[model samples]
Target: MSVRQLLYLAPIAAVLLASSSVVNGQDGVAEELVVLTDLAGLGRDENSVTYFKASNAGAYERFGESIALSADGTTLAVGAIFEDSSATGVGGDQADFSAPNAGAVYIFTRTGSNWSQQAYIKASNTGASDRFGLSVALSHDGDTLAVGALGEDSAATGINGDQHDNSIDNAGAAYIFTRENRTWSQQAYIKASNTGRIEEGDQFGYDVVLNGNGDTLAVSAISEDSAATGVGGEQDDDSAAEIGAVYVYSRDGADWSQQAYLKPRSFSTEMLIGGILFGFAIGMDESGNTLAISGFNEETNRGSIYVFERAGSDWFEQARLVASNPEIGDGLGSAIAVSADGNTIAAGAFDEDSALVGIVPSDQGIDDQRTDDAIGAAYVFVRRGDTWSQQAFIKPTNTQVNQHFGWTLALSLDGDTLAVGAHFENGGSTGINGDQRDTSAQDAGAAYVYSRSGTTWTPRAYVKASNTFARAEFGSSLALNDDGTVLAVGAPREADGAAGINGNQAADSAAESGAVYIY
Candidate 1:
């Protein structure tokens, strides 16, 4: 019998079919031994990378400080929290450097593996040091966008209130933008409903989240300092400092109204000082009926996640989740994601000090493990009727201290896939599943992907920046498409200053220029 070779290629990765082996980085360097067989479809190409930066990129802009992806992954929004552009609204002047740390958001659209800049966005009333892009969110279809300016000084209250008022200092504000066809226009300028009575330093837009339909929004004010608890509580009381709060808003036609104001209950308030973050992370299901808000209790140095469900026009707390064997400083709720159905939730304890390795069974909270300090861990929980329970515990195959494995995470629409980021990982490896043992590149960053089959979760891929560099923070932020087939990884500290995709990535010319990677 004659010997023969069989060949196969993923339909989505057909462009790379010419090359049997996968290459890493845009430098045209084959830094890995990975081949197409290992990839095997799902529209994933570990070897592929599309790099992006601000069109008017300057050093320390932190172009990828925040990021969001449309459900299909064709549209992307990148926030340059330190971007200096003083431009107001969409498609304004990006060259002027009058406004320092003003922040800006850049939108991009992809077609057949090619990405193009769609718009450059700024707050409606641009101001210096506003940090307008500190946080950003996009709707499923990319028709609606929200930008947070945690340093915004306006004391304006309600929707589309006065944006020119600079009376309040750091009261924070959020902006809503809607797209018609390919053009985008500002829809509203939102401030905390208690803006005037709250004084200043609330940081209302510290974090923001938008549902798939683009009609619902949840914004976090990490340092609201309210003694009030529960929804629609007394906002006038600011005695309890740093209590934090989350605001919900709903859109009808083109109008937006505040739906609810949520504050923590029995939360540790004394230690809320020293920059402790409460209600620092927020997540919402596609339908906007489910919400998960994570808060860190500074007193215990531990964290808790609060779940809420919506009924008619009211929102009520469902449960307060804590790690089964949570140790002090676990930081379990730094990052979180809720599935489309609102049944599956993944929470990240980026500060977790677990020394456990590999894919362990569901719920390992009983294990009193610690050696790799700040190695990080993630817990998956599934809801049944009105009950919620942990389903799986995840750690990387190679566990190392200071890895921060679960710093950020995302879930597919169906809740079948998950991606976790470790921006502090010190691996020099490139492409997927490379050498994680190397600690040469400090904080070069890496990402991990996993898939679920029924109740079992399995490791899928180990991802890294094509041009991995020390202190790049490659996984600082992450976003996944509806099907989890596409991913966007932000490396805010990436040194390459070049703008647009496929630019020179090997140079360390632009310090802190930041970059985004598409896979």
Candidate 2:
């Protein structure tokens, strides 16, 4: 039942070996593929594996659903939004279950080759169905952490405000935690500043990101229903239903303040009638001066990404990017990432149908394939001074329909390296460089690495979990260290009995418990 697969790219001498299972690429071709074994069978040469689960986690706890890594690769934050922990705050008892779905986050520290749990975090005002830790982000130094609770029903706003208020349903909120020495404490609480009377269903903290220095934070409310155009606009406007909004906050010394409220400038009666989830995805540069916001349902689901730049204390819209050959239902901005320096950006179109491989010309028409749906693609954009240009079109070598290749993305500090996740990829082969041709493993998922030289990008590696199983969703979430040397892939639906580092992955041992792998 276990096999080691080896794939060799002859020209590069880069050998990819899998543990439990082996899948070979095309025969006689320079690209000789190798598939490795399962997580329990990985060799010493393979990356060390660490499995994480809540101490009292149940079958549907989903411990590794969201993951964030420090720039130095020494610290990690994992989110378990479905964790039914009744305990509130840090280091509380984990067995209490009075509050169902209150959610929890786990912090881990790595020393040498061993990783250990450092802290268990929960909302200061933990309540039933709050769903804290739905999304997590760590500062470059790993000292500051941001946790989002998209299902939180609080009606509070601003920093450290009242969290007990639940007059609004699913209004959402985010928390900021700071670590000094090795102890962590709640630093601030954030909510939409412009949330007027009808604040229900805003889902303010659906996604969050922090700048490298942790001085700036960006949060998205994908269900924000305001027609506001810019900073401090009329937030009470309900004309735009689910148009979405992004909020930017800046820290001064120890205090954080709402800096700007961002919305697309194309907002109009027609747009308000058509816009949907404009801020579904967001990314910010290290300086916190540049930002990318995606409206995946814009233009009849063709999707668009908006770029914004900061000047003094104001943020202004810089550019609105769309696929050169825009097609309906392409979902071009479903996922996005920006480099540390704000010079590079990547946008994913998970529903793209083009079969073209590697870099495609920006002028290429959308007529490449009409039948191949959801083949997926990612586009890289480079900034020269104030002008931005599309630099590359990237795809996996084994691109196939419905793989959702760009469902998630992570970029290195320099933006020269990128990791793309295809959470719906169907390949029975497990581990790295496995046979991507097989479709037996439904939703097993895969990740791809690409390196950039000048303006060209080359495929570097194909990654997957050692214990591939149907619906494990190995590449559902991804995070890279500062230099892209360390990558963490999350399989939130993994059904393994494994609890902690290198445990047994017995078939059907645990269902939907989730797992995380470091490579």
Candidate 3:
């Protein structure tokens, strides 16, 4: 008896099919992995020069930033953050640092394939240096938008706007805008209670995600009050600071309020020990009740992931996951993505150690040291009974070391499909051929797709944009739409063109700009 092998295809369309189907023992089915990128079809303008195609489409550049999508996937609700000329315009000097950042939100309705700018929302009280539209997130239904203003001082926290001021007094804030009667309006402004203090500059409300109902919200403050719960601290002045945390807020009728403060469960001797609970990223469920948060720096050069559950309407810490293999240097959970039901979780560990390929002879063309260094990997966990356990631990079957397994992770709502990125993989480009030690292509990156069959999991495809330029680092960031039909990966260092798009050409050095790939 022989075991059938699974066939994996190019990651650009990670489609997989078994040599023989287990269900029928003789049938073969096609699998798919799609790639998308903004660099492909975009109109360049002074304000929105660099357009990105997220699930809905995203545009951000020097002058202004806008993100909008229609509820039906046909229309878009856009928001732009730019300087208000009335308060602060692009002064005569292009290098002038005195200009302020204030912007507005808009709602655009699209019909067929045609989209026209619908409404322009100017901040209610535009001011200098107020970058109102710093970040934006839409609900599953695309009816609600959450925007962050990390520079806003409306709550008058002690932290002055002085760029040189070292005081931790600025508590960042967020605004909720809803669409009613085809018009969008401000719904709520989120700020931690007692908004002003030296602890405030923790940059709260930097990133946000909303459930379908837009009632429950999760906000991340990479730097909040370390003394407060759910916040992480740091040691002295090494600059690897850890004042991080996240807050969960709930909405009742029209009133939105903070419901819980989430932090990692740790056994630390000192409150300032900085061992655990440095919140950096967060995602929530449809009701905003269930939450997932990432502490990219839980341990020196390592990270952890935390999950919280809401009982009825009360939110509480539920589970904490450090990589099952607790190697001191592997920073598991550096970035995370959670499903709408909170039942599925995907985590990226960009610095995971690997030994996938050991040694193969020269003429054979199988390179030794292929899986060396801290190549990334991703882990998946699913909820069962009252406990959650690892459902799958996936890395590309042919991964090389230093590929950075978990550069980014994404799981669909049903938990059936998963995507893992290895931003440093040598995808058959270098003449060195499949050797993990072959940095010939240098920092070239790649992504992998996997699917589950009952309790078993298999690699379905390996993908990289066909035009992916060499050393492009494409897997640094990834986002997957709920059904897993669309994926967006950021290779910020890639150049802008077809031939040298991904890692086609060696980088000028290691320092390069970034780009987002959509699939």
Top-lDDT candidate index: 1
Per-prediction TM-score, please?
0.90, 0.90, 0.66
lDDT over C-alpha atoms for residue 375 of model 1? 83
Q: Stretches of candidate 3 above 4 Å error?
A: 1-135, 149-170, 181-183, 194-200, 228-243, 265-267, 275-277, 357-372, 397-403, 422-445, 466-473, 491-517
lDDT of 1 by residue, 49-147 (tens): 677878988899888878888988888999888888788989999898999989999999988767899999999888898888778888999999998
Say which prediction, candidate 2 or candidate 3, comes out ahead on lDDT.
2
Clash totals in order:
0, 20, 58
What residue runs in model 1 are displaced by over 4 Å at the alpha carbon? 1-47, 196-200, 268-276, 362-368
In candidate 2, what are the lDDT values of residues 1-519, reduced to their tens digit? Answer: 000010000000001112221122221112433333332222323344555555555677777667888998778888877788788889998888788878888888878767788899999888888778777888999999998887787778888788888888778888999999999988888888865344457878878899999999999888788888866677878778778899999999879899998888767565688765777778889888999998878877788889999988899999888887778777788778899999999988878887665455666535575554787888898889989888887766676778777877888899987888887788787656656667798887777777777886766667777677788877777787877767777777788866655666655677877777776
